[model samples]
Target: MTQNIKKLGYFLLFTFVTLILYLTYLVMVQGEQLARHPQNQRIAAQEAGIIRGTIYDRTGTIIAETNWRGKQGERVYLKQDQLTPFSHITGYVSQRYGAFGLEASYSKELLGLTEADYLENLLDRILNRTPRGNDLVLTLDTVLQRTALNALGGRRGAVVAMNPKTGEILALASSPTFDANEIDRPEVWKQLNQDKLNAPLLNRATQGAYPPGSVMKIVTGAAILSQQILKPQDKIQCPGYTVIDGQRIKDNRSHNSVDFNKAIALSCNTYFALEGSKLSWDQFEDNFKKFGLSATPDIGVPVRSGTLAKGERRNLSQLAESSFGQGDTLISPLHMALACSAIANNGIIMKPYIVKEIRKPNGKPISVTEDSLWLTATDPEVAKQIAQGMVAAAKWGTATAASIKGLEVAGKTGTAETQGNSLPHAWFVGYAPAENPKIVVAVIVEKSGSGGIIAAPIAREIFSMALAR
Candidate 1:
């Protein structure tokens, strides 16, 4: 009996140690996640009394604010006309549904938890004064955002516009969107969740991943050029099709023979398939990763990382197809925008950001975002060479619709084929005033006909409006 008791004591001690270690691990590794979880009642209770901050656009246009109802704060999204346009960016804060988007990502600042003055917080706590959160100044331009949504014309799509040199997101518009104010209704929420086809709650601009189509030729051409596999003036014969490992990939039409720049301008599938097929797996994958695929943009909100097929499973055929942006590769609108921004900014991709400043309730600045380098996609010379090809594309090729009169526009268009019976997704990525780019835009129209027809025109309007500012 004594021996049995000793064994039980040993087991109890071991179990106790394991439990302690598990708890420690949770605290060390997942403490923040647990605290910020939507279902965390403790967090909800703590935030219930705090008056959240107001949100404003780059032009000081009010986006959202809070209304106090006797210690219970209610979030009221303003700008009635822009309710749906800014919904995905501002998100909603609810006692029942919790918070999301900028609201959840910067909740601490919105709850006044990260105030610069600890003594003021102490005094407020001692006096039991009502807590107010900091105000957020975002980089979004209201006019540009509205223009982007209007250009979509209620189509299911997304547009991301940003400053190439600074990475300040000027507009992020995702269509088939929802009004955050209505999400509080159980019936409305149920309907939104049930509509899986549109997925109104999903922020397509940053979250939706789609095949990039010929727009990916940008990366392919850059990769081949960087590796000395092809030169800008190198000529390749395009007989309307090219075979890779017994599979024939067809181009839009036969170009007979064209140089690298002309091939990009015309989006010659044959040229890219032949040239890209020469790249080794290491070179192909490295260029894609370097251009910001398989990684999420650090923009203080949820963003889906671009994806690529497993390297080990890759073959010559798959590589050829992926060279022009097909196969298992996928990229988000924001990711594509950053890639084009790299070329416009002298080969440097700046870190993308939305929030420009954080201000106290009294209008004093607390924090500000500064532009920083995220990646060097290629040498300046290589980027310049690629930019020239895109200029030609915009001038008279597939991306002509995106060109503005008297403005040197540089861009590439893509018509990404979809699965099943769905139509192809239209894509256009580019920047304005090629000599001195001011804004870079990425537009994707889901299940649309062609990038030049369906997407490039929209980018033109966005660029026109942004430059007009």
Candidate 2:
């Protein structure tokens, strides 16, 4: 009995020692992160004396700033009247609500509290003077952003526009956006949180995940071409429906027989389903990963990682459905824009960024963002082949609504079928001036009708405005 009691004592002592070691590890490694977390009210209290930075659009128009009244700084959003359009981009800052969006993402820099400025901060503290934060210049175009917001017509969805070659995000807009200026109010904050259906606070562009519908055909087509499973001239017969693993997957209409390019233009699900069945799961998944479809995007704000079902877990019918974008695969509007950008950029996907530069309050630039490559999805020639099909899609196929009068737009449309009787999500992803591609835009209208009818037109307006600029 004494030996057993001694053993219990030893076990308790070991567990206590392990707990101390873990606490020490956390303090040594994650102390700074824990302190800077948005939920940590200590940072907010400390920042009361600091003047937060101003945020500007690419054209130098102020979007957000802190107005000083005596020694107190009041965070103000300049375009609060047009609330929803800029809400997700600027986010909200409140001692009560903490911070969100860009405000939270760059809190240290915006508060003049980065480790690099420690000496300067100390000196300012010693002098009892408030330190002004560095201002941020974003790549977002206010005019284009507003245009996208208006184009959505107040639907529940998102729009993401970017420079395909440079990777500068021109606009990121999510509908049903709440007013950041009013988010600090207790009642308003409570209402926004309780309204789960609309989810006005969610950044749908980066955070919302939906099944990628027919738009995923782009990845499948690229993979099919890259693997030489099918040549551009290779022919396939697409019946209205194709049976796989004892389940039938149907296309909207039948294309009697089509070459590779024609199949993509028509978005023939039957053709893609058959093609998908031919490739091994590893080959199929590798192509999607190459485009970074299932990865968390590196950007200024927080984003949910794109997700797809594991190949090993999916049966033949499930794989066929996924091949046409109807499986368990889900992605964001931002990711779809990048996929379109890869084809537009000669197969190179540039890392998308929103911030253009950081400047001191005196207007001296401290840091400027440079364009960098994120991924090489395919060879230039393969991208050309995909572009040809996308061009056909925009010109005379399902995505004709996105075509501009003088510009050759290359695009793909998706009408994703959803469960529980709700309307399918409409999707359009494309780039304008196909040969000399300038802008890539992705649009999705939740529970909307057809991609051709609803989403494509919205992208057309954004493209026209962007190219006009």
Candidate 3:
């Protein structure tokens, strides 16, 4: 009996010690996170009292700042002088909803809570000086962003422009945007939340997903060339439609037998369908993954992955539709832009970056982020061939809509058909100055009949403006 009592006593002692140690560790390790819990109003109140850092553009234009009004108890965030022009990039920060965008991504540095900032703060404390939040400079060009936005003129679509060599997003514009200033108004917020047509809140550039249409042919061209089974000069016959497994797939325009250049230039559906079937569905899927279609870009923005429907290629008709960028493939404008950048940068794709540097209040660079390659194409030669084909597209193909005098632009246009009474989605993805690309632009117009007519024109205007700049 005494032994059993002693054993029970020892077990109780061990349990007590374990509980104490666990409590101590929790207090030491996760105490900060616990203290900053959403339910803790005290922490939020304290944060609301701090003077947040400013966000600037590449040209040193203030995009966002926190101003403390003497009359008001809390600090107010003025985004671009309380305007909504760059609201999406310089997202709003409210005590009620925490933070977002540059504010949220660099919150640690903005709040002087990151390790480096903490160390600096400690040093400042030792010297009896106040530690201030750091500023973030972005690669976004405000002039380009505004130009792209104004070019849309209330149209429902998106425009994304990136530096092809560095993958720095110069401009990202989504039309039907709302002003961030109205977010604090309950009545305006309720109206915005209820209105579906004026999905003014939607960030169409990254979040909107649509069937890539023929713009996907860029990927197809790369895949076919990489396999070494097809040559750039390969010839195929197009009889308006191709039949496989009793299914009939028709091209947008009828054409007779043509070579590879003519097939791509004319955007002949029948020719590509035949070529796509020869590659098989598995091979097509693998190549799609290789083109970054299976995953989203790591640009710290919300992006939807381009999807490929799962199934065996039963026959030529299915292959033809998929080859011409139809069937179950869907993609976002941002993803397509990056894919084009891959070809423009000679098979090497650089990861897209928005924020360029973080600096202390005194303008001392705390940290600088450099561009890095994200993916390399299966074959450098194949990329060159595709780039040539895209150049031909802008020169004499369906993307003639994007043809600008005195500029060699390589591009592809896509018109993806969908079910229902809605028109097909129009797409254009391309890069400027064919041999050495400086800018890559991807434009998408929802429910537009033809990519060449709808999306290409927008891209042309953007390219012209970009070159002029």
Candidate 4:
């Protein structure tokens, strides 16, 4: 009995020591995360008591700021309707609802909690002066964001545009957007959340995952080149229909005998189905990973990752379907745009970032977002070949609707089938001035008919406006 009692005592001692060590580690290593967590109301409440810093666009236009005149320390959005294009991103700063979006993402800096501001913050508090937070300069251009929003008017979809070389997001617009001010009204917030049909509060560009459809042929084409099974000039025969494992698959129309370039431009379902057969599903998956499709993108905010079918390809039928972006392959519009951006950027995918810099109220810089390479999508030569294929697509194929005068564009389109009797999702991804690419845009309209018809025109208008500037 004494021995057993001693053993119990030793176990208790061991557990107690482990608990102390864990608490110490958490306090030292994970302190910042805990302090800034959205659910941690203490720090958030304290920040609410203070005057939060202003937020601006890259051009120094005020986007968000706090009003001190109100007794309740009301956080006010400037030019409310004019800035609703930024609604989902600025989020609301309410004592009742706390902070969100960039407000939540940069909470610590907004609260003047950085090491550089520690002494100054302490001094300001001691003096009983207003504790001001740091300001944020974002990469979004109000003009571009407004253009994108205007282009998507009345459509239930999203648009994402970024610089290919720098990964600086220029515009991210989601239709059915709710004004941040709406959150101040509990009844309004409740209605927006409960409206399942429109989902005004949802940030569709980063969070909504959908079938990629034939726009995924760009990846399929890359997989073929990666395996060295097909050259740019190699011939592929498409008879409009092909049999894969006794399951008959059909294309939009017969593309006949065409080379690699024609297959991509025509989006030949049969050709990719055959090309996809050359690779095991593992090889196909490997190529998708090369384009960063299998990874969750670190685009300075929370985002949903693309998904393949739950399991490995069980049969050639599934593999062939996936090649044409059928079956269970799903991707966010941002993911598709970034992948296409890789082709525009000579095979290198730059890490996407929005918050360009955080600055002190005195105009001193606190932090600047750095540009870095995220992935190497393919060999330079292979990427160039695929880029040319996209050009052909814009010139003579389905994506002709996206071609802009006086500027060469490389593009691909997709019309993904979905459940119910509704129309398919329309998608378009492209980059312009092919020689010296400036902007890459991805667009999707849920339950819209054809990507070339519905989505491409919106992309065309954006390109015209962007290049004109």
For TM-score, the strongest prediction is: 1
- TM-score of decoy 3: 0.87
In angstroms, the error of model 1 at 443 is: 0.4
Model 2: how large is the Cα RMSD against the reference?
Answer: 2.6
Count of clashes, each model: 0, 0, 1, 0
- Per-residue lDDT, model 1, residue 231, is 77
TM-score of each: 0.96, 0.94, 0.87, 0.94
Off by over 4 Å in 1: 115-118, 311-313
Could you arrange the candidates by lDDT from highest to lowest?
Answer: 1, 2, 4, 3
User: Which model scores highest in lDDT?
Assistant: 1
lDDT of 4 by residue, 230-290 (tens): 7778886778899988999988888878898898788888988888877887888888898
Residue 9 Cα positional deviation in candidate 1, in Å, after optimal superposition: 2.7
**Model 3 ranges off by over 4 Å:** 1-43, 70-83, 119-131, 311-319
Model 4 has how many clashing residue pairs?
0
The positional error of residue 394 in candidate 1, measured at the CA in angstroms, is: 1.3
Tens digits of per-residue lDDT for model 2, 17-127: 999999998899998778667877877887788899999999998889999888899888866336546789789888788888888888888988877678878888899
Q: Write the number of the candidate with greater lDDT, choosing between 1 and 3.
A: 1
